[model samples]
Target: MEVRVLPGEHFYGFLRFYGKGITFPKGHVESGETYEQTALREVSEETGYKNLEIVKSLGVVTRPAIETDGTEVIKDIYLFLMKITGDDKGKAEEETEWLTIDDALTRLMPQEVEFLKKIQLEIYED
Candidate 1:
């Protein structure tokens, strides 16, 4: 998810929409890259924010499906509770909308919010 945190007691998230289906700002963990590394790189590339920090790990999302060519593919994606620790220096295309944290609770799909909340609460923990 591409996010921006205002200097307030609270912050929000932004939605990255490509089409009818919303796409998350993430990528497969590359060779020699840890889960956090991949998350940082993906967020930076997708959102153009350079200073990103993995506040915590969210979890893993796996999709095992058969490719169109008949080969079976198992896609395992790692998720994280990442934060924007730098300036929002880059501008995104018009398709990108700030997915407000409050709105995220309501606008996001149930499973998506549930899936993310499981790991994101760490930011509020002691």
Candidate 2:
């Protein structure tokens, strides 16, 4: 997920999946692409904001997930701290919204909420 501070508040970028609900932007890494590169591209594609810079690595989250075909798998999600670097905008390919920490905590999945809460203080200090 990406967070940016504007005036008095910090906002998180979230994508609304049609049947899956809201979550951060994520995608499979393309050939020859690093995890950071994939994150930057996916965020830009889903949020329509091209200007972003990675501030730091936020660690990783490994979880069990069921695929559309009912296959279960373990997924490793790499999290990063990123910030908006410019005002460039375009039409988003997916439904996207910028929400405050409190709103995001309520709307995100339990696992994700835990992750966010763990870094909440760090975000505030930035």
Candidate 3:
């Protein structure tokens, strides 16, 4: 997942998943692709913002997940702190929103909120 911050305002970029609520952009790692590569691709595909610079990694979060077919699995979510380098935009596959930390805390999922909280200070300090 990407914690994408827009410069100046420091608004965080989030994706709204229908029925699932708001969260960061993320996707599976394709074969022969590095985790960073997958993160960049997924962010672009989901938010349509291509001009991004990865500030640093926020580490990985491992959690149990349930698939649509009721399959249980462990998911490792790699978190990256990315910043928008330009105003370039494209077609987004999902709905995207930019929000202040307060607004994002209110709208984001519980787990996502927790993750944001853990890195809140780090994000601002960067």
Candidate 4:
């Protein structure tokens, strides 16, 4: 499942980042970029918000990815506390929706709500 942690005034919004079937803002350490750099770039490109920052490492998430069945993979997604830059008015990119962090968590099947709680408390990672 794809996930993005977004900043809000009183709390945060965890969103499902994607375009059609593709989750555009996936975190992959790019060449000549640190993990943080990768996070910033990916978030900016996908969300049009360039002020993303890695507040902490949320740990490595591994799963039997649907795109690659039976092949569990490990991904290093550096979770950050980020603020959106600029007005999102009239932003044309599709395949995204503004969902409450709670709702966003529920969007993903399985133990999604439980996982969201971990991030809410910063419990699973420091």
Candidate 2 per-residue lDDT over residues 1-109, each given as its tens digit: 4554557777878888656567877878999999999989988888888998988777776667678899999888787778888899787888887888898888877
Model 3 per-residue lDDT at 56 = 90
lDDT for position 77 in model 3: 87
Tens digits of per-residue lDDT, candidate 3, 33-101, equal 998999999998999988988889987766677788999998888989888788898999988887777
Candidate 1 least-lDDT 10 residues: 14-23
**Among all windows of ten consecutive residues in candidate 3, which has the lowest summed lDDT?**
1-10
- Whole-model alpha-carbon lDDT for candidate 1: 0.60
Instruction: Compute the lDDT of residue 104 as modeled in candidate 2.
Output: 81
lDDT winner between candidates 1 and 4: 1
Best by TM-score: 2
Question: If both were scored by TM-score, which would come out higher, candidate 2 or candidate 3?
Answer: 2
Off by over 4 Å in 2: 1-6, 18-20
What tens-digit string does per-residue lDDT give for candidate 4 at 23-86? Answer: 2245567779977677666666655654454556555433334434666554434455554544
TM-score (C-alpha) between model 4 and the true structure: 0.58
RMSD of candidate 4 to the true fold?
6.0
Residue pairs in collision within model 1: 13-99, 14-99, 15-99
